[model samples]
Target: MARTRTLLTAGAFALVTALLPTITTVGAAAADRDGPGPVAVSESRGQLTVTVPPGHGGPGYRLLIDEKTLGVRTVRAGRTVLATNPAGGFAFGDQHATSVTTWSYAAGTLRIAAASTAPADTVAVAITPTADRYDLTWSVAGAPAGARTVSYQLSSAGHWYGGGETSEGAAQPYPLDAGQVSEPDFSPASYLMMEPYWYTSSSVGNYVRTASPMDVQINKSASGLGDFTIKSTDSYASTVFVESTPSAVYQDYVEVVGKPSKSDATPAEIAQPLWNSWAQFYTAIDQNKVLDWAGKLHAAGLGGHTIQLDDKWESNYGNLTFDPKTFPNPKAMSDQIHSMGYHFGLWTTLWINLDSANYAYAKDHGYLLAAAADSTKPCTVTWWNGTAGIIDLGKPAARDWYTGNLHQLMSTYGVDGFKFDTRFFDDSCAPAAGVQAGDYQRLGAEMADGFDLQGAGVRVHWGNQKYGFVIRAVDAGTSFPELRTTLRRSMAISTDGYPFVETDMIGGSLGEPAPTKQVLVRWAQAASLMPLMYSSTSPLGVVDHTTGKPVTYDPETVQLYKNAIARHGRLSDYLQAQARKSVADGTPIIRPVFFDFAADQRFYTTDDEWMLGPSVLAAPVLSDSPTRTIDLPAGAWFDTVTHRVITGPRTLSAYPAPLGVTPAFVRLGAPGAATAIAALSHQS
Candidate 1:
């Protein structure tokens, strides 16, 4: 007679069996001496199981669920199973993709079932660990059409298990170790992959789950590839889901706080110009020329809270010394700027030039990172003026020396804040000796922490992307609370894209034409909602690099930017309050569609439209057309421009987007402040 089912029972064992019509059992003679010769097949209820023959090789074992084979592990000593990474799975053909791992069972079977949404399509796997007898299910959906297959492999002596497509034959395997770290390539066109390994020892009591922390490498392939990576660690304990698709989210605010006040007791009066450098620029063009611009800005009610002396305000970029011959009295420039109701702001970078007086000072202290062991690789890199070398922030002595100089300038010269620039380029320095790639994050964090300690009250002007790495520099009142926790290095989207605090170069760098009227209008409307906003028109207001400078500004463009800035200033009180609330609640002032309409299918893939705050919905036209169409969310919305009311969940066409207008609306009954920012009319 054909062999029937044979039960192996032990005290306190949790047994779950799935029986199928094709059930078959092996007799005692076929059982191996070591164990049950690795049960080839077992099934009961909805569960299925298969064990690999010990020491078996090739491409690990495969589990045929619904006739679709999913890869499993084949180990020599004991059985090993593969599971998906919680974050996501890797892309099949693209190096930028992410991946996930599956869970294994001690003595029980696992079940694969069809997803509720997609019938007949097995979209989930359930693993039952006999040790805990806990059934945990991992659902898989949202797999792009590109990833059609998933396979796994095991090598003889390598601790790294390889994973790839059976048909593709190319595998990217990561080593399994306690402290092993790798930056895995991730891109919009690829998928994310993750694998989990668990060690179970009878001598060690219970099974311990182990996973490798992978840094998702984003934007590594192409410049415009709209993809970003997120770092993952084994400490993460949460259910992971693959969202439909990802888009960028922007949040953060900028505030200019150097405006002078009429009363000496006011907040503005207490703030003073921290540094003076106007003499360097004024020496070229007489003192009268320098004062003329200051008077014009004051007369036009446009004097910045802090008067920034741009490049050339210094004798040299690398030289931190003052040019006494030019200024005669450096203190007078600071007093003049302060008397005119503005704090003085200066620009500086980390470079130390050979020609500068500080170069010898820095060299004597051994502050710079030497390129060669001989200390003579010439710490040089090209910048604005000429060749220079950067002071290594990673070293404590260097940080102390740099901070001491800055502190002296702040305390002695009354300098309020430093406009730091150009420290992001990593290629400039030869990798420091004894520095490893994993130490990058900690080193950056340490530098930021040091800056925070030194410049306790002073504000640091930071670039948008740099903010992700050194957020600790933002002072208490300066930082938006909501952005603190979410600022990661490689987010899915651009952090600077939103109208936030770090002054965004208005038209963007690279000498692109000033944003089109539509871009400006949208930017203006969005900016109006930020804590701080400023217009960074190209130097001399000329943007086209090809044309040498008969700089002509459109009267309309000037009026629009002027109006936008003034309007932003006028609503500063309200915007500041909103920003404070956003920080307190950990919600962004600029929210994407999914935030407000998560369950709404219509807004799932929408990127162009976003909410400025809780009440206002801004749909800025990205195209050049004077009029554009906008889709509104559900409920009634009051037109911010026309005051015309309309119901949402519908698209409105031919919305006017003239040079100064942005197609914006406020939800009806929502509390918000909307003020027109048109130039004042002078009627005779």
Candidate 2:
């Protein structure tokens, strides 16, 4: 769904999400040890080595992936101090915790209890084996009476990654700052845990399953240290999963959180070409304008098979009904759009704003979140459009009320699907009695139960991957740098495990000022190859009302747009098949090069180039360079555009990319994926 946004006067950027990532799966085997009883060991798929210092307690372990040391167990580094604040909501583990209470080791698991005399708080640490990862749980069973929080840390010695939850985060690594605590939020600034999960090229990954109210964060300290910390609200049990590889590890994570299977969503449905009206009309929409655009999209031969009407159509935020003044006779407009052979989708947020038609009624009931005694004060959060009473989907009646409304949008209005979108990704929602931020998706997921969900989240929780929607990149601008950031984030997100992905329309989002013809054409070409052919920002330009003539671009860019759409339309099935595979395992359709060619360490850090599904290798010209180098692994790659056979495991000179033609190659192994692309595209 498109965003209902006011340009951030500051940066004009938008919120974002990290796809299919969390948890690692590892399995059991014989236990081994280099130290005595307390220092037991489990050599499952990987290995977990525990160390209980010669005493009653103080037990920790070092995680290893592919026989590489993952991270050392948690321990306080210096002299410990104690502070108790009654009004405090933030706290960290004491710097000096040198005492150990007890330790035990069994088949593929380590359990240890520790405490310090200064704070008199007892902490428990357990390491369990899984199918593709090691699960480390740190729980504090008893806390000093007045103390509101305690902390724990896991230090891994290597370059860190996975906290790419900011404006241009995916393009670079972050300093180990606690994500939530630092209060640096964009729509979905890494849902804290310091973007809670990460991995290293040394072949390791981490996901912190923050147990309820507790805030966990991880980052690489400036002083050559990678740290993972969990700061609990009170007593907490924070779980961390450490594993290996972008694909295998991410799949392992998804296996636990769960993603929708092929049945829940058809690749064909996802492959449908979409035309959104946000860019063309913004909020200045009307029934006539919508119909005109729908007609224009198809008539222009743009291949926009489906139509998505973004914000401003609704009377108020979260109000499902179309505004009477702007969209009079909604059904008629829907019918007209459908008559033109286009699928229709509406947009909505989950909250019920006070300004909305349903707000008073929702507030009358217990549908909105509220503080302990303040029944009149609706628990609302302020964001892009003032304050609104948020829905507590956990309340079945409220959920049914919201979803029931959605069903009507489908049956009555002929709306085929929706984009479940959100703008505020901040962590202040009122969860049902004991619900935590991570569980926020409980309502978000259910809201999408019976629809074609073409939705996205600016900020999402840990279990969001289970929702199984095509995740779009954060709204991007036309600036070349934004495009580069988008590419990097796409690779990171794909590797993080979100495979079914879509990008912003070619010229970028409404946030970007108008783009140049060159930028627009190239952007469209890149987007055309993506799983979903989308245009939130319409490719059409200003139109003459009286004459009905196209006004914006020089003819070349417009023609290029049509051609790109037609080319991609021919290969929709190929892209769909890859999506099916993604649901089966955790394979990212748009993946980092290393996911497939793992043996080649050179591709481990590759960013500009990527695999579209399993066959097409696309290296877009991000800069103004006429040509760039194509790095091929030790295999044969057939240049789709050039129709030339190229051997890999080598770097070769590439010619400049034509305006809309990217330098792409088809892996000989995936003949169909490669050949089909080869036949449809070319190099300049």
Model 1: residues with Cα > 4 Å off, grouped in runs: 1-294, 322-331, 370-387, 411-413, 424-503, 512-526, 538-546, 554-556, 601-607, 669-684
For model 1 the local lDDT of residue 107 reads: 38
Q: Estimate each model's TM-score.
A: 0.55, 0.77
Q: What is the C-alpha lDDT of each candidate?
A: 0.37, 0.55
For residue 135, give model 1's deviation from the true position in Å. Answer: 18
Model 2: residue 614 alpha-carbon error in angstroms: 2.2
Q: lDDT tens digits, residues 436-499, model 1? A: 4234333543454333211112112211222322111111111111111111110112122222
Scored by lDDT, model 1 comes in at: 0.37
Candidate that scores best on lDDT:
2
Give lDDT for model 2.
Answer: 0.55
Q: Which ten residues in a row have the lowest lDDT in candidate 1?
A: 199-208
